[model samples]
Target: MKFLKIILATAIVLCIVLVATDYWISHKAEGYLYSKVADIPKNKVGLLLGTSKYIATGGINPYYTYRIDAAVALFKAGKIDYILISGDNSHISYNEPDTFKKDLVKRGIPENKIVLDYAGFRTLDSVIRAKKVFGQYSMTIISQKFHNQRAIYIAKNFDIDAIAFNAKDVTNRYGLKTRLREYLARSKAFMDIVFNVGPKFLGEKIPIG
Candidate 1:
């Protein structure tokens, strides 16, 4: 009985520690990013994060749609001169960068002004490569608030000045799962930063200017 009690106490403490750590990291990031467009500082480039257009149920993914819309808004407002669409292109058929490129063009962003990073398989890759590969020291990031905060945290670690332009958030059932997952992601991001985790791939330098 004593052993079981000790195990239960340890598990409870671990859970509380995890929750507190996630909350603290998230709060730190929230202070740096601009949730509103009027407050966002202009940068030469905007980093558009990628998500699949279609969910497993074949319904349109709200996150994908909202991110593209936010990127378009930033461009039309003249708040950003160029856009870097970053995402996974792990397989021939699963090209996230091209998907964002096609959608952004259709939304009226000129093709020449759009750059694609096909190797942004993870948020860490996208944020780090935005500096290392694309040569962008400062840029606006477009994504949902939770995601933007995490990305901004990563950017701050690498001395990249990044602000977020929040996309319209989905508040439905789907959003709940994502929000929960974000806690775990934030915890992992803290560990990644502590360990100085680099991107999985860093090819030759690709200048955006």
Candidate 2:
């Protein structure tokens, strides 16, 4: 009976901690998120965070489409001179950065204007690599609002001047699952900051002009 009570108490405390951490991260990123193209400040590079183009059900992922749209809009508006595609290339078949580049090209963005970082496996990697690997201390991050919030928080901790262009969000059943997962992700991000965790790969510097 005592063990059962202890387990319950522990679970409750963990839930509280998770919620608190989530709030802290979102609050920290409040002023850094932008939903309109005209309202956002210009930056030399726009960091296009990567995700799978298709979801598990083989449908086009709204998150991917929206991010690409956001990137294109930013470029056309003269808000950013270059688009930095950062994402995972873990498996031979999976190439997030390349996929994004191709789509951006198809959308009429010149190839030279888009640079790829094939090592952004996590949000932390994407944020850190933007500064360490790509020589960008200030950038406009592109993703959904929830994702942008977390990314902005990470950027602030790393001393990067970063703001986010919020892509249109998915609000279906899948979106609900993603939102729930974000709670745990926010907690993990907080711990990553506390522990001074760095990117998994920091290769030779690639200057972006």
Candidate 3:
């Protein structure tokens, strides 16, 4: 009977901790959004991170495409000077940054205005790589509002000048599943930054021409 009580207590505590942490991180990310939305500078670059397209489904509106489109809009608006599409280029079979580059070109962003980071295998990698590899201490991180916040938090942690532009709202699409996943991801990203988890690959600091 005592063991059962202890187990229940532990479970309850964990649930509370998870909910509290998720709420804090989500709101923290939201706060950054509120502060930077009206102030996204024209001088800053646009850094669009990548995600999968569910290749088997032939989906058109992947989160990644939306992000790139957001960057393109920023470029067209003259809100940003360049678009640095960074993501997982982990293998010959998987090349997100290249796909992002191609899509940007297709959308009328000049090739010279787009840069790719081959080793940005995760959000942390993208943020850190932005700072160390590309020398982007100040730029606009474009993604879904929930996503941008987490990235913004990490960049600020490293003392970088990162603002987030909430990409065209993606609602009633990913639903609760993606939000739950995002909550969990934000938590993990928070821990990773706190512990200073390094990237899977730290390629040579690619110079931006």
Best by lDDT: 2
- Please write out the lDDT profile of model 1 over residues 92-175, one tens digit for every residue: 999999999998999999999999999899899999999999999999998998898889889988999888888999999999
| Candidate with the greatest TM-score versus the true structure | 2
Lowest lDDT 10-residue stretch of candidate 3: 29-38
* lDDT for predicted candidate 2 compared with the true structure: 0.96
**Pairs with steric clashes in candidate 3:** none
Model 2 — which ten-residue stretch has the worst lDDT? Answer: 200-209
Q: How accurate is candidate 1 locally (lDDT)?
A: 0.90
Per residue, candidate 2 scores C-alpha lDDT tens digits across 1-209 of: 99999999999999999999999999999989999999999999999999999999999999999999999999999999999999999999999999999999999999999999999999999999999999999999999999999999999999999999999999999999999999999999999999999999999999987
Indicate whether candidate 1 or candidate 2 has the larger lDDT.
2
Q: Which sequence of candidate numbers ranks them by TM-score, best first?
A: 2, 1, 3
Candidate 3 lDDT over 73-96, as tens digits, reads 788888888888778767798888
lDDT against the true structure, each candidate: 0.90, 0.96, 0.77
Off by more than 4 A, model 3: 1-4, 34-39
- Estimate candidate 3's alpha-carbon lDDT, on a 0 to 1 scale: 0.77
Indicate whether candidate 2 or candidate 3 has the larger TM-score: 2
